[model samples]
Target: MMDDFLTVIALIISLNAVICLYRAAVGPTTQDRVLGVNIVGTKALVVVVLVTFIQTESFFLDVALVYALLLFVVTVAVSRYLEAEGWKEVA
Candidate 1:
């Protein structure tokens, strides 16, 4: 019963993550798109962990961890570049 519940929740997360991706693709500003991507990435981590639990394979969570780390690095890099370009967070 718990397994089924987890699966259902994972599916919901997947659907929401897809919407986040669509938003990322069509967002008006780079920051808006980046926010979308960040949210999607967070959802991906949860999805991956759920999959790992469903499959009884703990190793899948390691992949999610690495993905999160990479996402952080990419976000930081983009933020630095934007800062250098004089993009202000005045909004």
Candidate 2:
């Protein structure tokens, strides 16, 4: 029963990530797109953590941590890049 619940939650989070993809692709502004991507990444991280609990795999938690770090670094880097002088015009 608990496994089924986790599965449903994971599926919901995955669907939300897909919806976020549309926002990331068709957002009116670059900032919106970036925020959408960040949201999707955060959803993915939640799914990964859920999977760890559902599958009873400790390694997945490690993967989630790494994924979280990568997501943070990339988001920060992209945000910094978007804030640059030349990118301001594009934004």
Candidate 3:
């Protein structure tokens, strides 16, 4: 019963990720695309955690944590670069 619920949740997350991919592909601006990518990463992280529970493997949780950290760092770096570039354009 619990496994079935987790499977459904994971499937929903995967569907949302696909929608995010669409947004990333044709987002109106760079910021929109970045936001989409960030959201997709978040969804991926959730899916990973769900998988950990479904499979009863603790190692996947660790992998999810590492992936979350990487996602955070990458999003910050990209946003900072975009901000600097935007400032340059304004100046």
Let me know the TM-score candidate 2 reaches against the reference structure.
Answer: 0.92
| lDDT digits (tens) for residues 1-91 of candidate 3 | 9999999999998998998899888887888889999999999999999999999999999999999999999999999898774354321
CA error at residue 25 for candidate 3, angstroms: 0.7
* lDDT tens digits, residue span 1-91, model 1: 8889999999999999998898789887778878888899999989999999888898998999998899899888886787676566543
- For candidate 3, the 10 contiguous residues with the lowest summed lDDT are 82-91
Q: Pick the candidate with the highest lDDT.
A: 2
Candidate 1, 39: how far from true, in Å? 0.7
As a whole number from 0 to 100, the lDDT of residue 8 in candidate 1 is 98
Candidate closer to the true structure by TM-score (higher is better), 1 or 2: 2
Weakest 10 consecutive residues, lDDT, candidate 2?
Answer: 82-91
Q: Compared with the true structure, what per-residue lDDT tens digits does model 2 show for residues 1-91? A: 9999999999998998999899999899988898999999999999999999999999999999999999999999999998888554443
lDDT of each: 0.88, 0.93, 0.92
TM-score of 3: 0.89
